[model samples]
Every structure is written in structure tokens, then in C-alpha cells.
Target: MQRRKVTLKLYPNAAQSARLEAWTRLHCELYNAALEERIDAWHKARKSISYYDQQNVLPQIKADRPELNELGSHALQQTLRRLDLAFQLFFRRVKAGQTPGFPRFKAAKRFAGFAYPDSAGWRLMQHGGSGATLRIGTGEAAMSIRARGRHRFGVEAKPNDITLTRRNGQWFVSVTLRVPESACARRRTGDQRRGVDFGINDWATFDDGRTIDNPRWLREELPRLAALQRQRARKKGSLRFKRLGRRIARLHERIGNLRRDFVHKETTRMVRQCAILATEQLAPKTMSRSARGTVDAPGRRVRQKAGLNREILSAGFGMVHPMLAYKAEEAGTRLHLSNTRQIKPSQRCSACWELVPKTLSQRMHVCPCGHTAPRDRNSALVVLIDAFNTQHTPGTGVAARPKPLPRQRGKSKSVTRETPTTAPLGA
Candidate 1:
């Protein structure tokens, strides 16, 4: 069995919405109080407070504040569990020689959700098709909410936890269910293999001379965002500014949705065709650093570097690898991350295996042995070749030859464009 999460938008009436907000506020309060307790206890007595120590006093707390009793005990306990997890992560980072950010009290904005860790306090009253109804609490405080979305899991799937989250004034419920592996879509297998190279202008380049164009949604939306920011700045703290802020938020959400949709479709298609895949290992965070340096010594081309960084991030370079990995695992495909340092795909020739250095401005791979192709495409082929060579097995290499795309007469930019080709599974 594997766990899958399905998120659905919740539609609550005025009263139900109020009740949810109240419960969320109570949970936030409880989380903050718990964090304060731990900090104070440790500072005053040099002692650590375990989860159980705080949980044992819950009975007395409820007696003192009758209002909290209306919220489900299971939900409150889950909030404490979240706090415990936060502290655990802090300590883990400390042990790893990383910055140890101690868990801080959560404000209402930070604590926008609560979880039902078990099935005892909540139930999925009606679930099917495009919608479902969720019930929480009991008796007088019992609340039912209508949820809208296409849930991928079946009724037989066991729901392990339900998390209610509020984001940008929208309520959503995330249901984590345990379903049998057999219940998932049929796993695909194939002999076809390919290599992919990620880039900013073109989303991805394949060894077979095809490229996926980057949508650049963030770049397109930035002008409107800037305009909204200007308007908000002129009327800060006014109703007009608040309204513009909401508009900006909605635009950001739309950009995210568009990026996610494209990534899902492209990755799913790629996984189906390539049973064995290869790509250069990348560190996006290191690549997309701010160009502005600290006081002592500043960086050059600060504005230009910042623009390049924005473009790289807008292309969703970081999200692609993880998406491919999980999808490949589900489809029973292999994804090999070739070491960029060792292979140096961009610097090496795919055909002759000779080191041919090129600057960022050189978009064409011109080798001394007369082998040439688009820079990204050549890099992808090099990645495929290096991965196969490193493996200690025969008959595991890809058969497709990298065909160099035709370049424009005046410049090295390739004029040739080809559509992405996907092979049928088991072909």
C-alpha cells in the first residue's frame, strides 16, 4: 500500500465558515501556547518538555476554558504533534551543522490549518464523483462541509488523516489515503530510453533534437503585478490597496496553476516513453542565487543576473526533477541522474567524446570532428552516452542518434523545430 493525497476545495455556508474560522483560531492559539510552554520551561529550568507532558494537562486546560472543549480532542492533539515535529526538525538541522531555527509561536497567518490525525473524530459522510461531504466534531459542534474536486481514490481506500487548510481566503481539505498498489493505474514498461536537458528559454531539450518551450508565465504576469504594487503603494492601508493585494495574490495563484499543469502533462508523457531516462544532476538553489552581494564586496551585472535568476526560477527547474522521479517510480521506469561534475555534458562532445569548450553565447555545439548540434540537444546526448558508459551492463544503451538541427544562415541559432515524440508503452 502507498499513501496518496487528494486535495479538494471546501464550500462552507456562512455559519459553517464562521465555525471553521473559530476552530482554526483555537488551534492556532493552542499551538502558540504549547510553543511558549516549551521555550519558557527550557529557559527557566534547563528542562525539555515532551509532548506527553503537555498532553497530560489537557484535561485541566479544557476544564479551565470550556470553549476549547467544543473543538475535537483529536484535532488539538494533532496540533501538538505538529509542534513536536517542528522541534524535531530544528534539532535535526542543529545536529547536521545547519542553522537551528528554534520553533516559534505561530500567529494566525502562519497557523492556517489543523489536522485530524486519526479517523475517530471525523468522517467522510458522502464521497463520490466530483464532490464529497466531510463531517467534523460531534453533537452541537458537529459541522459538515461540501467539498468540490475529482478525488482520485475510491471509497474502499482507507483515509489515514484529514487536514483542513485555509489559504488566500479559500478553504481546502487534504485527505491522505492508503490504497493498495494494485488499485493504481497499470504500470508501464518499455525498452525505449532517452536523455533530457533542462534550460530556461526552452523548458527541456531531448537527445533526439526536440525542445519543449518554456511558457514564462511569471514573466508575462510581472507587468500587471508591478502595476498593482504601484497602485497599492500610493494608497497603503486603504481598501483599494487591500483589493489590489488580493488581485496580485490571485495572479500568483494562476501562475502556479499553469506551471503545475504543464509540468504534470510533460512529465507523465516522458515517463511513458522512456523506461530508462538520464539527465544531469542540478542544484537549482545554488544556481538561482541573488546577484546582490553583501556590503564589503558587491557583484557585477547585478540587474542582469537578477533577471536571469527570475527566468530560471520561472521555468520551474527545481520542480521538474522531483516530479519526474516520483512519476518514474510509479510507472516502474528508471531515472538516472548523471553527475554534472564528472560527465560535464555541456563541455564534452556527444559524438567524438572530445572536450569542446563553449561560452553561454554559443548556442551551437561545433566539434572538431565535424559533429555539431543544438547546444542543449548535444548536452542531452552526452548525458545519455555517459550514463550508459558508467553502467556495468550490456544492451542497456539508447539507440536513437542525435540529429543536428539546421541552423539559421546568419546566426548559430537553430531554425529547425520538431514536435516531441512519445513511444507507446511496451513498443
Candidate 2:
């Protein structure tokens, strides 16, 4: 079985929308109250409250607050579970010597969503390919929300979990479904492998020289976004400021949606065609680090570096490789992640296997062996080589193909190679 999440945009009448807002506000209040209780318990008695301690008090809570009876008991419990998970994460981070960002009370505006741990509280209907109908709670008082989305979950989609979220004044319900792998299978006889290099100028450059141009969505929208910010600053705390804030949120939402759509389409196509997908393991956080140094020392071209960082992030370098990985998994294809530190793809010449280091400004990779290509494309070629090398010799790249166990299937064949499967780095 495989898990897939489907998000549908919800359309509700004024009455239903108003009720949803009230319910959302209640959920936010509950979250804040629980947070305050935990803090006070620690400060007053030097005691920590567990999830079970709070959960045991839910019935009394619902009894005292009659309005909460409208929501299912399961959902209210899950909200407490969510808070427990946050504290768990905080502790884990502290143990690992990382900053422990203590869980804080959520403001109503920031608390955008809540989830149903199971399918008991909600039911979804997909009558056609274009849209869906979602009913939350039970009986006639239940809210029926008309939603728009083409449901995709192979042959059959079995909803296991659901969440209702509001983003940019739009309501959306996300359903997590369990699907059978056999039902979703699409057979392909492809035996080819391709390496991809992601960048700022071009979205992706395949080892074979094919390129996808970066749309630079954030860059294109920056002028209007900046103008809106300036106007909002001028009208701060006024009604106009709130309206402008909505506009800015909507614009950001649109850019993110379009980028995700583009990524899904492109990745689906690539996964379908290639048998093995090899990509560089890029650390986007490290690459896009701020150039503004501390007070002791300053950095040069701060604005230019910041712009470059934004461009890199806007290119979806972080999103693409992960999408490729999961899509490849679904397609039963191999995904190779070459280590950037060891492979040094950008510095190595793909043609001659020689180190030809170049700076960020050098867009063309020129090698003494007469190999010349776009910097990103050449790096992609090196990644391809490392992938093939790792296939024969593991540990050469980030995640090499796993060696099959002898007992699981049968005895391993004793076929031997006469020469080296692939040349060494310096050879």
C-alpha cells in the first residue's frame, strides 16, 4: 500500500463559511489554552503535563464548553496530540545540541488548520473528475462543503486522514489516502539513466543537455510585492493594511501553487521516461545563506548576494530532487544522489576526469581536454558518471544501489569481470 495526499479547494455558502470560521477560532483558543496550562503547571509546581493528563480532562472540557460538542471527540484529542508532538520535537532538538524552539501559544490568525486523526469525523465524495463534495461531522447539522479538485489515487482511493486548512482566505481540505501499488502501476521498459543539475538561471539541466528554463516567479512578482508591502507599511493598523495583507498573501500563495504544479508535471514526465534518476545532493540552506556578516566584519555586495539567494530558492532546487525521489520510488525506478563534497561535480571535468575548478561567475566550464559546456550541464554530466561508477562500486556517491541478498531470492551468480568496471577518479 502507498500513501498519497489530495488537497481540494472548498466552496461554501456564507452560513457555512461563518460556521467554519467560528469552529476554527474555537480550535485556536483550545490550542492556546492548552499551551498556557502547560506553562503554568511548570512555573507553579515544577511539574510537566503529559498528553494523557490533558486528554483525560477533555470530557469535562466539552461538558463545560457546550459549543465544542459540535466537533468530534477524536479531533479534540488529536489537537492535544499535536501539542505533545511539538514538545517532543523541541526536546529532540535540544538533545542534539540544536536550538530548542519551545512551543509557543498560537495566535488565531496563525492557527490556520486542524486535522482529523481518522476518517470517522469526515466523509468525501468524488462524483466526477473535476470536483468533490466533503461533509464534516454527522447528521443534518453537518457542514457540506463543495470542493473543486480532480482526485488522483490510482484505481481506488481510501481516505485514512483529513485536514481542513484556510490559506489566503481560501478553504482547502486535504485527504490522505491509502492506495495499492499494483493498482497504480504503469509499466515501462526504459533502462536509461539521466543526471539532473538544478540552478538559478535554468530550472534543471539534464546530463544529455536538455534544459528547462527557470520561471523566476518570485523575481517577476517582486516589484508588485514590494509596492504592496510599502503601501501596507504606510497604512499600518488600518483597514487598508488588512486588505493589502490579504493581497500579499494571495500573491505568495499563487506563486507557490504554480511552482508546485510545474514541479509535479515535470517530475512525473521525467520519472515516466527514465529508469534511473541521478541528481546532485544540494544543500539549499547552506547555498542560500545570508551574506550579511556580524558587526565585527561585513560582507561585500550584500544586496546582490541576497538577490542571488532568492533566485536560487525561487528556482525550486530544494523541491525538485525530493519530488524526483518519491516519484521514482512509485515508478519502481532507481534514484541516485551523488555527494557534492566528495564528487565535486562542479569542479570536475566530465570529459577528461580532471579537476577544472571554476568560480560562480564562470558560467562556462572550460577544460584543457577541450571539453566545454554550460556550467550546470557539465556538472550534471559528472553526476551521471558518478552514478554509473557507484552502480559498480558503492560508496562513490551518496546513495548507491543496494546489493541484493543471496538468501532472499537465490544463490548469487559467480560471474566475474575481466577489467575494472569504471575508471577511478584520477585514472
Candidate 3:
């Protein structure tokens, strides 16, 4: 499935805003009530209630309460559907050993209405303009308009939730669109495979020894950002403080936009170049703990590392792999997830086939057997070898094998050694 998201700046008149607020409240109420009903049913029968069953009751309820018709029957039904979906997700997570709490009532600042694929509650007011019109309630008081992007297409806007959010004194609506799966299939396909290593020193390392250095804009701007924040705090709610707050927010926005741009460009380039891509499965929360420094210089190093880690996270190293997987599928390419631990791509010698243990600070690969190369390049070669072996192995397991020491011409042969050990690779 292909999904498109468009965020529009909403301009709602005072009356329209009030009506939208009421609709949001009603939607939230229906959602909570539906959730309560499902929980009661599940408690009684010990079986999950299906979304369709809950949806089927919407029309009857709408008919019984004619007053809710003005709030948009389609919207109310969509809210119920979302509530059902939320419960389904929570149940799934609980089964996976996750602590997923029950769905709770939506609060005002966090409230949003919904529209389904089959609902008529949502429509595109203007097909092409600075902004499009959206009708939330029956009356004109609920009508709102928003700006449009430069690109105008004849594609019809499917009924979906328009989430209203207030950020930086601006009202915005996140519009979700369902597009044909073929839309993102324009990428090229290739047979080459790749492995990626993510690091704080270098944002990412390819099997080919290429490294994308982290920009660390936040680290660079931290002093200015801290100063502005301090100024804002000292000034409190005064006009000067508000102005400083806006400045700080804008600085953050700038850094975020830059990071996003960099990730998009880098991921697109990598995806277009290789068909099959592999990367380490990283847990950001676990990784962040190691980023702190010693007690002596705790704050300095911790802040610096944290800033760098944040940039790496925002760069979407983890997200890029999944995106490439689906994008590769659309492009008729195969994307594989390889076991990085067993691979030991970084520690293995590519030329001499010896295990070369090195610290993170070592940027060059120097073998005692007279082989030398860039660390990242050597790691990449090791990854390629692992991939080749994985494809050739009969079973799914990554069995260990002795490293083939480099042969020397005219030298005497020595006795060989053999050892059986557990495989290093695990998915």
C-alpha cells in the first residue's frame, strides 16, 4: 500500500473554530464509549470484538440520536473505527510482551476527528488553490480553508481524518491520503547488495568504506539555543520573552528541517544504487545509555554525545532500512536483513581472513600480515563475504568457519588447527 501525507496550515474563522472544537469533543466521546463497550464485551466473552461489529452499530446509534447528525455521522463512525483499531493494536502489543495500556479518553489539546475510506464526512473544497476548503460540521460555521502546495493533481482526496494541531502559534492539519502502490515504484533496480553500519563518529558506514559524517547542527547551535531559552525563562510571559521563545523554536525548526533534508537525500541515493541492503538492528534507548561520559566531565561529553545521537536518530538510519525494503519491493528488487553480530564485519580482516580487533577510535585497518586499508572499507568487504556465505549455506543458520590465513610463496607449511564454535550471526 502507498500512503501520502500532506500538512496544511488551517485558517478557521472564530465561529468555525468553535464548531470544530465541538465536533472534536463529540468524536472523542464516541471513541471512548466505543472502547468501553468493546472492553466490556471482551471481559464477558474473553474474545476480542471485531471492528466491523462495532461499525455496524454506528448507523443505528446515529438514527437514535438525531442531534449528533449535525456533528457528522460519517465522522462519528470513523471515530469508532479508530477506537477499535487502537484496541486491536494494544492487544497485539500485549501479546508481544509489551506493556500496552487501554485506550483512554482523548483530551482537548490532543483531540482529533476521523473520516474513513467509505465516509462522506470529508471532502476537498478546492482542487487547486493556496489552500483547500474542509467542512467539519453541517453548518457554514464549521467550514475551514487551508493552503495548497505548488503541485496540483487531478487525484481525488479520499475521506480521512484531518488532525488539527497547534504548534508555534500556527494551526495545522495533517491530511493522510491513500495513493496507488505504483506511485513509489519509480526507483531503479539493481543486483548489488550492501551492508550499513551506524555510528556516532560517522553517521553511517557502507560496506564500501564510504562514510557520511554527522552534521551535528544541534551541537553547534547549543550555546545560542541555551542562551535564547535562558532569556525567555528570565523574561517569563512578557512580550520580549515570547519573542525569544519564537526565536528558539525557529532555531529548532531550522535544525530539524536540515537534518530531514540530509536523510532524504542520503537514503534516496543509497536506495537507488543498491537493490539489497542490510543494516544492524539498533535499539536507540539502549544505545543512548552508553553515550554518556565519565563523572569528571559528565555534562560536557554527555550533552555532546546526546546531541550527536539525536542527529543520528533524526537522520532515520533505522527508518531508512524499512523504507528501502518496501521501496525495493516496488522496484522489483530484494531487500534482506542480515545478522550483523555474527558477521563481525568491522572486526574481520577482508584480505588476510584474520580477526583484527580494534577500538572505535581506530579509523584504519592495519593487519600484522602487511595488509592495510581504511577500516570502513575492510568492514564492508567482510560484510560482502558474509552475504556470499549466507546465500551459499544450505540451512538458515550462520555456522562458523576457520579464517583462511594468507598464503606465502616458498614458505614451509605448518600444522593446521580446527575448532568448533557457535555461529556469531543472529537475526
The candidate scoring highest on lDDT is 2
Off by over 4 Å in 2: 186-191, 393-395, 398-427
Order of the predicted models by TM-score, top scorer first? 2, 1, 3
Q: Tell me the deviation in Å of residue 30 in model 1.
A: 0.6
Q: Assess each prediction's global lDDT (C-alpha) against the native.
A: 0.79, 0.80, 0.62
Flag the better candidate by lDDT, 1 or 3: 1
Report the C-alpha lDDT of model 2 over 196-295, residue by residue, as the tens digit: 8888778889988999988888988999999999999999879999999999999998999888989888888887777766777888899999999988
Q: Give one clash count per candidate, in the order shown.
A: 0, 0, 7
lDDT of 3 by residue, 200-270 (tens): 67777887778889787677888998898888888986899878977887898888778777776776676
TM-score for predicted model 3 compared with the true structure: 0.69
Which parts of model 1 are misplaced by more than 4 Å? 125-127, 185-191, 390-427
lDDT (10s digit) by residue, model 1, range 1-427: 8888878899999999888888888899999999999999989999999999988888899999899887878888888989999999999999999999988877776577889988877887555578788988888878888888765556667888899999777899998888787665435645677889999868899998889988999999998889988988999878898888888888899999899889988988888767767788888899889878978888889999899998888888788888877677767666767666545789889887767899988999999999989999999998777555544432222222233223312322211111122223344
Of 2 and 3, the candidate ranking higher by TM-score? 2
For each candidate, what TM-score against the reference? 0.89, 0.90, 0.69
